[model samples]
Target: MPFSVPPYRLSQAIRDKCKRLHVFVQAFTLPSCWYPHRIRILAPHPVRNKCGNAVRIKTPKTGSAVPTLADVARHANVSTATVSRCLNSPDQVVGETRKRVLKAVQDLGYAPNFSARALAAKRTKTIGAVIPTMDNSIFARGIQAFQEELGRHGFTLLIASSAYREDLEEEQIRTLAARGADALLLIGYHRNRAVYDMLTARNLPVLVAWAYHADAPQMSIGFDNVTAMAGLARLAIGKGHRRLGFISAPGATNDRARDRVAGVRRAMREAGLRDTDLSLVETQYGIETGEAAFREIMTSATPPTVVLCGNDVLAVGALRAAKEMGLRVPQDVSITGFDDIELAMLAEPPLTTVHVPHREMGRRAAGMLVQILTGQGRPDNVELKTDIRIRQTLGPPPPER
Candidate 1:
């Protein structure tokens, strides 16, 4: 009797040898009992033993072997420094040399390691933006414009959503900062002082957007929310809407919502109407929530003649709820919304709302951030303007009924 290698161990041994030699066993079989055996060897080719079944082997993969700067330089027959200059400062290199270097980069599928570059350059050339939500189109247009402008300046945008939670926004701010964002774009100046202190400690340039206050401590780029909403409220009041109803987002957490509510009160005071003349409801921002809030306001003992909403989403919801309640818009009860989003225009009867320059605000915000990052003097706070879009929804109270 002779000792024999176990089938599993023998197979593993063959596999190990095959990997080292870059070849594989095509087909093989082991003896059923303990016996001495011999395996025929093949170099650089598939090896088969007794069985017809081929034991297939795969060639080793080189996919993880990333092409580096030196690889690009060698492929282009240039120095690594020349390759770096070509990528970072292409204008400094001659046209022909630049073309050759770029071609080699394309051919070798070489991508510069941005992590190393950011480490050496001490700037990631990236901006982080945190908004309240992404579930609606309210911030969509502005963010798109912001990203486009940043791309033109060779910087990338990293966006995160806080879902309207201040705690989450603070976490996102720290996370973005830790990940090396060169600058930041925050929605409002309502966050905790600790967050601002952290940004200051890190020396990160920040620009506040979506709400503008002349006396805000931080640099900001946005319209005056209070004034804009006040202008809209005045128009509604001028139309003789003495008995007013307002559907709004929670004012405590959001400066924009709070300021808009202040604007309505300002208009009410200007018109000599007591605060009791206006009915108010605060809810989350959504079409359904708007509908529910509208129904609640209208079912009161003294219902308003005109319902003013915080934004277009809530206004559209109110428009639907009003129709359900058999109330004719402007004739029976009027409705007005803020933010002039696309839904405002597409409402059953186009919404009477305030038109904000969302795209312009976004672009200018990016420009201001870039200016600060590039060591240009910090730009002054910008105040964009808003207009009132009077559509079919707003009108005088119904015949004093």
Candidate 2:
């Protein structure tokens, strides 16, 4: 039996066409040494005559084709374990043997699995901090010092800012803890109960800073806001400033501001003046807010001779406003502030403010937290001193006019 072509199909014509196509393809066929299945259909190859023969070719042997660690051990005259130790813990092997195995590894470019080493060590050597806000230089400066101190001890610091929201701060704290932070640093004593509970439940060491109260529930490392502010108020009164105005943070929930206002009232009472003689304006902590608060006091029937600000930031605003109003600072209007930030000295008349030891506080806080983490001691209350930086902004009243 023989194959037959249908109508309109010629057997001789089909056979001739197939023979021509085979020649066209054979001209571009890969070398016999090349893996035919691995080559793309459209891949280019050396051209050849119709003779069926392999082309002389060479290809680089990549990792998938080459011998691995086991082969390296066999070639090095050592066990696989000895080969791995030479690649990793070289000090554990004899010097001469280590050199031989290392030479074999170098020749083969064998890389040990780093994941295995990391799993064995089980330490990231990192610390975590959550602060109220980085926008304010207070936290930024303090956190910078904290990180520098941590770096000195060969530890890395991871920081997150909550922008003064308690909920966000707590969530960030949890996130850092979950990511394997050995210790945590927080700002201020006031946080949600659940945050404290979370840390307690995890047995995590936590340190609070910024504002300090002797009997706070958590460990704290800071200063007495009331005593520091009150001392300044008493000093201002002693300098013959009978009419005093206080520019402070809204006392609604800020204990530090509330205590500062209390200090001013206490000083006024001690000077045989009615508490009414002291006018207090609660405002946000900003230069603009300080200016507005100062203006409000100035427009009063009994304008104050001395104005005390919650912090140096507000004092600057008050000073700028006084200058704009054609008033001479410390002469027409004496001003004092807390937290002698760098901006205090940069003012036209340097600010007479309390110098909060920001860097020292941060360093001390880190130390206390480290102590707690290492079981050296439990959390304790710490109160660092706040000294007065007497500059040109504070002076006696203008002849009691």
lDDT of 1 by residue, 124-233 (tens): 98999999999767689899999888776767899999988999999999999999999999998898999999999999989999989888879999989889989988
Best-matching candidate per lDDT: 1
| TM-score per model over all chains | 0.78, 0.68
Question: How far out, in Å, is residue 168 in model 1?
Answer: 0.8
- CA lDDT, every prediction? 0.86, 0.78
CA displacement after TM-score superposition, residue 20 of candidate 1 (Å): 27
TM-score of 1: 0.78
Going through the candidates in order, what is the number of backbone clashes in each?
2, 0
Off by over 4 Å in 1: 1-65, 68-106
Clashing pairs in 1: 26-54, 26-55
Residue-level lDDT for 61 in candidate 1: 50
